[model samples]
Target: MADFFRLNKVLIFGVGLIGGSFAAALKAAGAVDEVVGFGRSLPGLEEALRLGLIDRIGESVAAEAPDADLVLLATPVGGMAVLMQALAPHLGPQTIVTDGGSTKHDVVANAYAAFGERVGQFVPAHPIAGAENSGPAAARADLYRDRKVVVTPLPENSSVAVARVCDAWRACGAVLHTLTPADHDRVFAAVSHLPHLLSFALVHDLAVRDDRDMFFTFAASGFRDFTRIAASHPEMWRDICLANRAALLDELDRYTAQLATLREALASGDGAALEAAFDSARTARRAWAEGKLV
Candidate 1:
């Protein structure tokens, strides 16, 4: 099938890892003629250009957005509303607006508030890809390859706009899946957000211990692997946790209950119960890793 949208320019609202990687991937595929990045840091945007991730720096969303056929808001979830409002008047009817946000409900709400009847052009997406490292320097053209990009189109979204966003991700070698904004938040809250919070909590716990230096000195591969996500950008995760607060809190409560059960088992010397719990988790993880479950 032919490409859905051939872009003259793709305006990126943040020139960090996600935005830089998107620009690099699309530029490498020849899907976009130019990638203009709008960001707070001129030096950072310049660095992205120097690395060839973007073609130019955008001085203002009002000025840059008018010329862009597609605008990818790769900013943090908290910043989406402001950026959407800023771009509202500048966006043309033909321009498609999409975002790379971890949480969608708030972003979709921002879209409606900014564009109203023109919300059809706004398609919300969340790319299930990233690394512990961030910034333009950490961007990779193949970051989205084989990664899942979830598209949660609002009711007012035009089919053309949704398809164009899906096609753009596909062009970057990402697999696409569609879900409602609520469903996306619910699933990711349990799988992604909860784990990240656990990781952060674990690290924070260790960091406050009296033997903290000793703990770090002896920390092994297991600790490193388990705490990797804790190293991610704090402000970004903070916004996501708050944006999907209800779902995240529900998942957190369930996880805490499980931990309490395990703790009781350990304290009561209930070896059989502990063994059964461990075995169940081990079996389930094995099945997931072996692709028996999707």
Candidate 2:
């Protein structure tokens, strides 16, 4: 076991959902001595403080970054570049910088360019957990428990820095997983991004149809469950979609082809083909749910 080091004066940029929840989790776990939140918005910082998500508020990234033992970037993916540039000069040699950005390749690449070898201290991570709701008001300290957190370390990353980040996630009750940045993007493009896109498209299609109200009235558990991701933040999803455009497009094309096959099977009343496909999917899903497959 690695010797546990309690973090001191952690600085969190962006006190919204993920950031706020992380601050609350670290505080509850007694892993950090003090949590300082910095954001462009004053209301969010006030709310985070009021909710006990953070101990103090930093007036600016430059003022806070140098003092933090751990600096976390929890802003939207689209804002990472700007934040990276702003904090570059202020980051101390010993500070470990990490981000909760959904996409890692671009964020990590930009960090390397901006901070050079100091980027070795930056660990890119994505906690695969969230609710439909966002902001400090919706933040919950227990949100990270049992969640899978993927950390992508570049060849230049310091082993000590990586271990420290893995320890932080472990302290927060997360199951840690390591992967290359490319692999992370490819896997999530299929499992996370594609499903969200399909859900939003399905809901939009229903809303524009003549029988929209009727369809919604009859919608039950399955429909509700399937479309739940459609309620996620539109701007965030839009950024994700654009960030992983190539992988997402490939997955979209494959999904469309499968949908076409199902459509043709239904139109032609091909019972045998339909039954075989459905049975295969059901067995696969059942195995997945039972943890029988990797």
Candidate 3:
């Protein structure tokens, strides 16, 4: 069992789905004494408070960041740099800052540039859990339970800060995993990011076709499962695709080549090649299902 401590107060910025879920989890687990949500919108703050996601709502980042033991940035990836710049002047020396942003390399760099040696207080993290939904209303307290939470610590990051961040996630029922920012971004590009792009592209391609509605009406569970990620926030996915462009593009190219090879095999009536390929994929998928990937 992992040791857990009750944080004095945690300032969570942008209490949308991930943020709201995190707050709810902390509250449910009795891990935090206070959760102060900072958002520009009054309705969002009110909703979060009503949902019991936060103890109180702070009006501004400066006021909220200074008093927090932990500060979690849960906004979209593109907004991280701007948010970090805004919160930089107000962060307390003892505060451990972390994020639920999908991309790490850019976010880690931005944190370093904004805070310099104070970057040691920052631990960049991405929870490998979320839904195809947004806002407090869609959040659930148990959303992160048994989920993998990846913490990417830079060279400047303090071990104490990293451990604190890990403990916080553990308290929320998440299993902690450590990875370098570069490796995290690269691996996620193939396993997580690429699938999201493919889903969006597939749905877009189908929607644009002449018989889209007719085709969709006949679609089955497999289609729904394959395109579930397409329902994710467009702006967020757009930012992720652009942020992890290099790794995503490489994975996309590899996937396209594999698809082309399958098509060629079918056209050439190569039964043995098709069978071998299918068997290989089945074996790989079965291994994944059996928990061999971790």
Candidate 4:
């Protein structure tokens, strides 16, 4: 029941939120004919296959690589280097690979190490879309619709490979933008990684308190909104934080500096200084929200 059938066969590595969503989106759009999935859990892969997110369960990367027109490494960043090494040995000439790792520089480095001269076949991308929940059950075909996807293509990547990666994301209704991997990591550290870190830290702080139950009982919308991302996958975020630790640490330092400034303003009873800072942040946030597409 495919329409265009742009990809004869696609291989998915994780079969979780990002991977499941991609497969579902592509299937819904008739963009691909068959999807073969590889993952650590047999039950999870079975669920993905049962949900029609993928057609078959893939065994060996070497066995599957020759037939995969495209491969998506949707696993955590920590696992990427091994996956890259596995695929590098048997990839078809036309098989182009891309990943959903949040930290791009490390992923790009992993590709360089694994692919070497064939590194051009791997295009790096980060989809600016996620939900508190994960796994195949949490995936939906519309997850990436109108979402921003950053593609950090290597200099060695050919135009054709880059175009195909862009087109794949487009098929999921994502808006594509390009950046150097370093810039992508730095920007995401401030906007994405830092926020997740803060959210997780805040939740952890509350959970470890003596009056934790009381805090939970009285928590309201503001707390809920701020800590929503605390519900994200732990191992994935751990890898992201560690992989992009340098940039994340710098952003964290800057954030702590702002916190210190606010604390000083409060201690000095400088309502005006606090108000000025709050107003500036409010205005910038409003402007960003107004122009935001996702």
Candidate 5:
């Protein structure tokens, strides 16, 4: 199917890491004939063009959206509503739209509002991969290789549309998975969102401290590893946290409760409790790294 399905011309709404990577991977695999990019700024698009990530910078949706095989909304979730409304009128009958938004429910809602009867054209997706750096220069053709891409298809989507989207991801060497938008938001809130939130919070807490420089100077591998995601694009993560607030708040409260337990253990000098909790986390982390727990 990967060999059978090919994109003649693809439109990318954001020429940053995710979208640039998609274009690069497709070009690398000889799967896409042409790639057009549209973004918040021309300089970014020009950078993507310079990097060979796109064939051209899109000037008008009306002119390019009609014949493009796919349109990828790779911007922050907060920008999707405006882009959806802009693209809906010019969107072609066969042009299937998909996204790399971390939160799916909000994306689906925006699609429903913009496309109405044509919501089937928009297939919601989230690629479970990224790096610390961003922009066109940071994009690599192998970024999505062996990574999981979760597609939360609306009931309005036809089998053919979903299959074609799946094939495109496979061409980028991604593994496909499916989930409902609600489930997708809920699951990622617990796993991905919570971790990023904690990472950001930990770094911020340290940064505001009077001895921040001292802490940073003494910080080592463990601190660097834990706070790596804190350096992620602030605007992007801000949109994700707000978009998935309900689920994220619930997970945050649960984490808070766990933190309380740890605080109590530390205050009471409960060595056994600390050891047990650390041991459990160590076991789980090792199991996950070994691919023994899925």
Candidate 6:
């Protein structure tokens, strides 16, 4: 059989970093014939066209999706409802729809709402590769190389559709892992989402302090590294936080309990208790850093 990824046309709903990089990678690999971008911003679309990331730009996914063999939604998780509604009527029987949403549960719910029994056509995926920078200008063909792309296939999803999505990502040089939507959201909440929230909170807390300037002046590499994610697109993170609120809140509670334990240790001047807690965390982090856990 011919490769399903070698498509006649691929529609990218949001032609920014993730979408643009995907287009570039697939085009370079000869896995797609023509890539068309659909989005609200014409200027951004034009820039992507100029950068050779897309062959054309259209205003309506409903208008453009009918001809597409594949539709890649790279917009924020919050945009899923709109995108799904627009493309619902136009998706061909054989067309494969996938997304780059960081959180899967909400997007999967949106797909079920839009496509109903045909939700199997929409495969929910999250690419672990992300950059502090965004937009079409930051796109690179190698973005997914050696990176993990997690696919959380819904029960309604067809095996064929899931396999095709996996093969496509593999062709783009991504390592594929399969998980349930709940598992994907829970894992990401604990690891990615929680860290980002903490980073933003820390930066915001420091910013409002009376000695913010003085504190910043004395800050070093550790602070910079920890807070780097705070520079991420605020709107995107906001949407993610809301969409994955349940899982995130669970993680926050667990984290807060840990903090409370540490605070108790510090307040009681229990150096040994503090040392034990710190040592356990340090050892776990060191193991992960050495790729023993990851």
lDDT of each: 0.90, 0.88, 0.88, 0.92, 0.93, 0.89
Show how many residue pairs clash in every candidate, following the order shown: 0, 0, 0, 0, 0, 0
lDDT of 6 at 100: 94
| Residue 61 C-alpha lDDT in model 2 | 76
Query: Which regions of candidate 1 fall more than 4 Å away from where they truly are?
Result: 1-5, 214-218
TM-score of each: 0.92, 0.93, 0.93, 0.93, 0.93, 0.95
* Pairs that clash in candidate 6: none
What tens-digit string does per-residue lDDT give for candidate 2 at 125-217? 999988867889988888899999999997878888898888888878889999999889889999999999999999999999997989999
Expressed as tens digits, the lDDT of each residue in 50-147 for candidate 1 is: 99999888877777787778999998888888888889898877899999999988888888999888898899999998886789999999999999
What would you estimate as the lDDT of candidate 6? 0.89
The best candidate by TM-score is 6
Model 1: pairs clashing at backbone N, Cα or C within 3 Å: none
> Which scores greater on lDDT, model 1 or model 3?
1
Could you tell me the lDDT of residue 205 within candidate 4?
Answer: 94
Q: Which lDDT tens digits does candidate 3 get at residues 29-143?
A: 8889999998767899899999899889887777778878899999887888888888888888888899999988889878988887788888999999877678889888899
Error of 6 at 133 (Å): 1.7
* Candidate 4 residue-wise lDDT, 5-54, digit = tens: 38899999999999999999999888988999999999999999999999
Candidate 4, residue 280: the lDDT equals: 90
- TM-score-superior candidate, 2 or 5: 5
Q: Candidate 6, residue 274: CA error in Å?
A: 1.5
Greater lDDT among 3 and 4 belongs to: 4
